[model samples]
Structure formats: structure tokens, C-alpha cells
Target: MTATRAIVVMGVSGSGKTSVADGLAAALGTAFIEGDSLHPAGNVEKMSRGVPLTDEDRWPWLDTIGQALAGSLDAGKSVVVSCSALKKIYRDRLRQSAGGALTFVFLKGSRDLLTARMAARHGHFMPASLLDSQLATLEDPSGEAGVVTVGIDAAVETIVARALDGLKTVG
Candidate 1:
């Protein structure tokens, strides 16, 4: 098994965060956290109504995720968490909260691919309309500390395998 560490599966909506995160957790023999579940009820409601969350709307929820990441690490366990950490600042906040190093797996894909994926998705609160906003918000993580980028233009299994490989390589 890999060492106990937080692996944040980050990407825009429809970038296969859940599937990749789940695969990573299973591969790493660790726990998995769906970050959207940590959102406040109001946040969910707002997003469901097509309103994008502002920083104020996200702070408390981000704090929750940070705490969970820190707590899990303190307990000597690894976790794979899925979060749309679109901006560098958000990633910084999460990394600080983890209280240790975070290995972020950034799922990168084209706008067309993402749009198709989002359109095909069912039962997700985020609408396909939000993709452009998210894409605009994303600050490329190129050469950032403790981060690895993986292309989402492949099969889930291939993506997972590549991510695991990348993790090993980066570490």
C-alpha cells in the first residue's frame, strides 16, 4: 500500500473526479471522501438553482474538507478526496488544511469532452451551464508543488492507472 497521504482528485465538473478518486482510494487501500457531500445545504440549493458559489459560500465547506483531510492524516490513514479545486487559492487552502503534503491528481480534459460528459451525467446538481465558469476559474497547476496532472481523454481504467503511475513517479 502507498503511504498514508491525502490524494485530492481535482478537476472541473464532469472531469471524472468521482470515478478517478474511487479508483485511487481502492488502489491505495485507503478511504474515499466525496467532497460535494460536505457542502452546506444552502450551497447545494444555490447550485441546484444555477447559482455559482462565491468564496463566502465556500469558506465553511472548505474548512470542513480541510479539517477532514487533516483529521484523516492525523489518524494515520490515507484518503482520496474529490473536489473541484479550480483555483490555485483553493488548492492552497486545502493543502494547508491537510497539515501535510497533498498529492493532487488534476484531471485535465478539453472543453468539448467536458461538455459531453456533463451533458451525459444524470442526477448531478451542477448544470452543464457552469462548465465555462469553472473552466475560466481554473488556474493551471503546471510545475506546482506536490501536484500531478492526468489527461481525462482516455478510459477510466487507463486514467486511474496513469494517475497511480504518476503518483508513484512524482513521489
Candidate 2:
């Protein structure tokens, strides 16, 4: 078996993090964790009400994701997780928790495209109203080590393929 790797599919809410991460996990034959599902109930409620989460509100959630990644890596298992790791600090936290063996696949897209995608979605806790907040908070990870930036303008399969190819360079 290939050595275990920890990967985070990160982007704004509408940037297809879930789909791409799911595909990536399947391709890698690893567990798929939806980071949003690990959020505290209060945080979900706040987002469901269209309220932007403060940094304080996000710390615990980020910690939870980090712990999940760390646990998988410690068990010698590859894992893919979906997270809107918009800020550099959040990504750094995840890296530290995962013992620095982490790579991120950043899904990039234009604002117009993201807004349209958010608008078309249904039954999601995050509202389109929070997209601006998320975009504002996003720190582009393009030049960061262990980071792969894949444009979200293509189909999910293409995006996943691009991410896999990019991972070859960083992983």
C-alpha cells in the first residue's frame, strides 16, 4: 500500500469542496470527512441564520478537523477532508495538529461564479450572504508549500484530476 497522506480540500462555501474531496478520497481509497459536519451546533445555527462566524467561533471547529486528520495519519491511513479553511492561520493550525504532514487542495473560482453556485444550491446551512465574508477572509494559498490550487471552473472530474496531478508535486 502507498504511504498515508493527509489532504484537505479547502475553499469558499460554493467552490465545490465537498464534491472534489469526495472524489479525491475515492480516488485515493481513503476515508472522506465532511468538515462541516464536525462544526459545533451553535456555529451551524449561526451560519444557518446568515451570520458570519468570528474567528473565536471557528477555532474549536478547526481543532476538531485537525484532530480527525491527525488520528487518521497516526493510524497509517490516508484521508481526505473538506474544509473552508479560508485563513492561513486555520491551515497552519491543521498542519500543526497533523504533525506537519498535510497538503491542501485549494479550489479557486471567481466571485460571480461562486455566488451563482451558492444561489443554486438548496438545503445548505451556509447562505449566499456569507460568501462575501468568506471571500474577504480567504488567504490565497497559491505559493504556500504543500498546497495545490485547482481552478473550480471545470467539471468535478477534471478538477479532481488536476488536483491529483498537483498533489504529485507537493506530496
Q: For candidate 2, list the clashing residue pairs, or say none.
A: none
Candidate 2: residue 117 Cα off by (Å) = 0.7
lDDT of 2 by residue, 129-157 (tens): 99999999999999999999999999999
Query: Residue 39's C-alpha lDDT in candidate 2?
Result: 99
Q: What lDDT is obtained when candidate 1 is compared to the true structure?
A: 0.90
Indicate the TM-score of model 2: 0.98
- CA displacement after TM-score superposition, residue 163 of candidate 1 (Å): 0.3
lDDT of 2 at 107: 99
Candidate 1: pairs in clash: none
Each candidate structure's TM-score, on Cα atoms with residue i matched to residue i, is 0.97, 0.98
Top lDDT model: 2
